[model samples]
Target chain A: MALDKSLVSGSMTMLILKLISERDMYGYEMIDTLRQRSNHSFELKAGTLYPILHGLEEKGMVRSYDKEFAGKTRKYYSITSSGMAQLEERTKEWKEYSDAVRGVLALEVSVL
Target chain B: MMEEYIRILLEQIRCKKSHKYIESEIRSHIEDQIEENMSRGMDPETAERMAVNSMGDPVMTGTELDMIHRPQMNIKLIVMIAAISIIGVLIHSLMLHDSFLQPETEMISGHYLRDVIIGLCVMTGICFVDYSVIARFSKLIGGAIIALKILLIVKSLIEVNSAVKWIGYGGIWMSWLLFDMIYIPIFGAIVYKNSRQGRKGLIKSFMWMYIPVFLELLSANMTCALIMLISMTAQMYLAIRKGWFGESYKAAITALVSGDVATPSIAASVVKAFGSVFPTNTFNLYRDIVAGFIANDERNYITGMLRTINKAALLFGDSSSELSNSMPAADNQYMLTYINCHYGIMVGIAVCLLIGWSLFYMFRSLIKQNNQLGLIVGTGCLMIFILNLALNILINLGAFPIMECWIPFISAGGSCIVLSYALTGILLSIYRYKNVYPSDVDVKMPKLKLLLEQ
Candidate 1:
């Protein structure tokens, strides 16, 4: 659940890459983190998430490995350099988006 | 924990539903929720429940999601309209090219659009409108199907270019103007809905389909009629599993064997006319001996009379290409060639396998119930689609590689593509949106027969 909102909301895809940025996690784990990180404010449903993940995997934005962990073997994901680059670009865009939104909301409303 | 949730989520997807897209979505949401909860120091179990909860009732949520995501947007429709319209125009021009190939692109394009519009409107009317509304006119609908089959007779008689393709649309030779398409869909709906009671009802429902097909074959429009017959049979087979299979199939076979095709009055006359003629006839000599008792119709007799002239067209018709020598004695499926050309036969094979595997897993749950009828119908429909595609491609290759066999999803004829997709949407709407059984939500639901569990 510990995810960067600036990254997750703008395009949670980079967030996916960021998850894989450090280590590989399977589809389920990737989704869980996005939801928990958003404090239930942003629930990453399967509809939105899997297609992005699939797109990422299809584009080789990330790579997956199946390994035996705990008791069950799972398909874990890791970000490729392409994914990392995508994450960085998305993060920059996110920061800019947040700042712009903040600036707009931050405007003093002359209550007329 | 998220993984386990996904595993269970997959189980709940139910075979009757369209799970292709949403399967991934559900998995994503669960994972997203779990990660958030886990970071908050919630245990895996707590995280899992929280994630599932955030998914906001999978049924309602899935329906909403599909509405947003599935391809029914105006933009998509327009693109489809443009592409399909062009194809339709091309076909029209090709059919009439011998008359005038007026070397102008713009004029031809406009004509194609007209065909596109007709095809699209018909398909749209099928998909969007309430099937039940269409069902009420079952007698009229069934009659209309029979009527369309009869058109082939007209085609055979006034045929041109060695093919029984056109009906006289004023002065034009209208080829592949598929009015009979409404037959399979409307007939399928009627049979499934009407036969939802007892075996006799089911059998009678099937007769709705069979009579038209027999009429079609007799009219010598065997090709289109065969497609409808096969598809309807597949649909009926599905209805049976839905516990709606009536004596329709049996009735049809009996009617055919007994030489009775239509109403009782028609049946008696047909048998008599044929029975009285063939004292020394080679075929159906036995049927002729007993034909005094069994009944038949003048419809076939009438069609047989018509076919004498059409038999020549059959010996030399080319439905696809307008050129006299463009097609072969036989035509194959078009969709397969397109797939093979674009994706390669290898990839096409793989894609089919992937689809097959998912479908297999899907029915695994449904088949877990003992509703043999539902399983049979579902499997039969799939088989029919497969067979239609295969036969269409074979026909195409044997004659013209550029064929009209439709790619249900991939093909660009907006009308046809949309038509197939509507079925997928229905399943999703029922399973993911409505949740499990299509219910009268207020009433206690009867368990629909399932192949998996009793």
Candidate 2:
């Protein structure tokens, strides 16, 4: 099933920081990596990704530089130490949230 | 198809500085998507359409980016500047009212008010101007000012003792010496924005810095030359710290140390080269004149009088000894000492604190700037304020040699007052646009080559 639009939007910053934490990636690469990793279950819009990346950069959570790949100039984003800390925090919070939601749903199924 | 989409997106973003980078990044993303789609056996037209479709809602993205990059106003800085300008006017009025210091000529009474008014207006006007213009044309602007100074120097040589420093027309005069303070900010722009990358760029920036310093020395304005050297060197040190020239820290430090060590010899050589062309050894002549005054302290009228008044000054009220009517440039250069004698030592300290506080406030804000151009230009402005205030206060306290320095904002001199305001305005302009520019946005104006570089 496709993810809820609002759900993806709310956690977009964490997702972007998480991707960049693995390695420095350009804008298009991040979108493609996320889509394949999710087995095409998540497809991020380029328009959505860039604004969040730029915002994270402004907040010093990430830094960016331009690099040439295959003779094409691409603007690449990389996570800073602060971004790593943020990703860790957000990952912990997400795990707790999903676990609680699954627990409640299981309880409802048993009751029914 | 992608071009139209990108254009529409950029239209929604108000900050022109972010446009070029955003457009390129978005265009590349769409192109990458199109390549992937075509590899899946889709037709070129369909692949292009599909790629553009995936990047949702350009207006929304642009608006969100706009909100992040909008121009910011620094209200506290504006208020502080206004307070300082008001304090200047009030102090000048107080000086005018004092019977001992009141000038015999009518010209002296009205001049301070006129200068302050004009200054404040010029400052307000400058605040609205985008300071990026300085960065954009850093070479042209820096070249033009240096060219003007060289022209003035040539004129001075031809005319023989017809004041090279003052440029006057129709009863209005400006001291090129006072105006040279603007070069500090212009120098910052050239180093940060125009200079090429790495060691060659470093050498070129130093050359740009010394030309003015050399010109000032040639004209025998040691104080102006010294101020330019110290401030520009400080700026270069800052650029090194920022790694603008891509040099290792050790290499940068060595270059700075050697530059500082070499300056005095360079200055001495310039003085020696021009000594015969001029009537006297201008450098040593100034030194000897000042040394003679110090040796014969009782005969050195201004310093002797200031020393006596300072000794007699009370902590919170007027001193018993009156400041003599014959105090030279009493309204401008000696305004600080006059305040101590006429008002109180405490009041003079309060004025000093006001000026010091403004400097501290400005420095605090300046360091926080994310944009390189803003930081460089702002540092230049702050350097001028710090140097002028330190020299003026030291002279007032009889700790430094008395020269033609004026306390920024508070002194009653037309050129000094206006120049101080203009510098403050530039700082405010930098602060005003702080958020509007991203850290990596290229500010260099295109298609213009530096005349010197060619």
The CAPRI classification for model 2 reads as acceptable
Clashing pairs in 2: none
| Candidate 2: segments with Cα more than 4 A from true spot | A14-26, A29-42, A56-112, B15-18, B39-42, B102-109, B279-281, B289-308, B321-328, B441-454
What is model 1's C-alpha RMSD? 17.5
Clashes of each: 49, 0
| TM-score (C-alpha) between model 1 and the true structure | 0.37
RMSD from true fold, candidate 2? 4.3
lDDT tens string, model 1, B3-113?
554555444544423354345445644665577789999998888887776554444444443333322223333344344345434434443443322333224333444
Docking class of 1: incorrect
| Reference-based lDDT, residue A59, model 2 | 70
- lDDT of residue B220 for candidate 1: 36
